[model samples]
Target: MIPISVVVVVLGGWSVLYLADTILKSFNSLKNSYENWLALHGLSIAPFHLRWQTSFFNRVFYKFTERSFKEIFQKFSVGMVFGVIAMFGSMILLAKTLMQTLAQMMEEAPSVQSDHVLQVVSSSSRIFTSRSILLSLKHTQVVVPGINLPVSQLAYFFLAILISGVIHEIGHGVAAIREQVRFNGFGMFIFVVYPGAFVDLLTTHLQLISPVQQLRIFCAG
Candidate 1:
């Protein structure tokens, strides 16, 4: 039998997807209606409605690594080094911020004894976990945060995933153009506000394209 906790998590995730689709639809409808109203008033519509045009490369480096990652890195050693450094930095910063916040809060509270405050601070993680465990009781509250989080992460990790994901999809589309394969615009998936880039090889997939070519295009993304 599937565990109840696991079932709740899965259903909660699906609800978040539904919420994102609704949000995107509403935004698009509003933009179109507003643009039509502006046309009636003789005001030109604003340019650059692109909320997702984030590019990752500065031409030179992008072309430099156009070849296989194996060719660029020669091995996975450099990537491994970068991954370790990023993780260590994130952990240290998070720990320092958490500690400073807790200390400041304790200093402002004179009625709470230092020992008692320390005990509560140490158990904060336990309290957070318990709150999450109780999430099934208010499923929408749990799901909305899950839905809206990736959009928030995109703002901060813009340098990391947004650029990379865009470049990755563009590389696929460029490859298809090079191979003379029929293609469509780049595909996209917008979840709540969390967007993802995808390659549009729908016709290629249906047609009997060589597995090797498909593999190359897929890997570009």
Candidate 2:
């Protein structure tokens, strides 16, 4: 049975979101004006997502990049190397963790079988225990509100993701600008529950740059 608190929280959240969307759509002139403003800034919006873009950060990128060529190259070169190392390290760690978890599950398989037999003998206790374990495993494998994570913590999770994304894109933008690549714009978006940021650069400019400079730009994020 679903908890009453969980039901209330879900309904409240949906109601708030619906009300906000309705208010925005109900004001025709306001909605049109907002859309026009977003368009002017190279932004766009769709259901469950909003993209805001602007070239206002170009000056900051340029300022950061304005340094001796050798110094800039050395800094980004170090970043590129460390980024490669971290990428491989993370892959290895993830693989190792997955192997360990699989081994542990295998070891627990007999216990699960035992539980099944016990369920047939003492139906109530064993059935409840097995169900609880299955539910916990399900929630562990997937993010489920009120199961894996509380509804109240969702806001902080999203906020942290947004901040990390913004910083990541900023790094790419700065690195591209330093490599003499054209920094077209920066943008952010929220797609459903996930938040992300991106930097736009001229493809032609990227193609013209040396491979080392390209590596720096790619690894900066």
Compare the candidates by TM-score and give the number of the best one.
2
List model 2 lDDT by residue over 8-78, tens digit each.
76566656765765677679878887656657978665555657888888887788778545686787789
lDDT of each: 0.49, 0.73
Q: Model 2 Cα displacement at 29 (Å)?
A: 11
lDDT of 2: 0.73
Give the poorly placed runs of model 1, Cα more than 4 Å off: 1-154, 187-189, 204-206
Q: Write the per-residue lDDT of candidate 1 for residues 129-217, one digit (tens) a residue.
A: 33223322332222233254453453565345556777777766655544446554444444433446665555845356675555454
Say which candidate scores most in lDDT: 2
What TM-score, to 2 decimals, does candidate 2 have? 0.66
TM-score of each: 0.33, 0.66
Q: List the residue pairs that clash in candidate 1.
A: 20-192
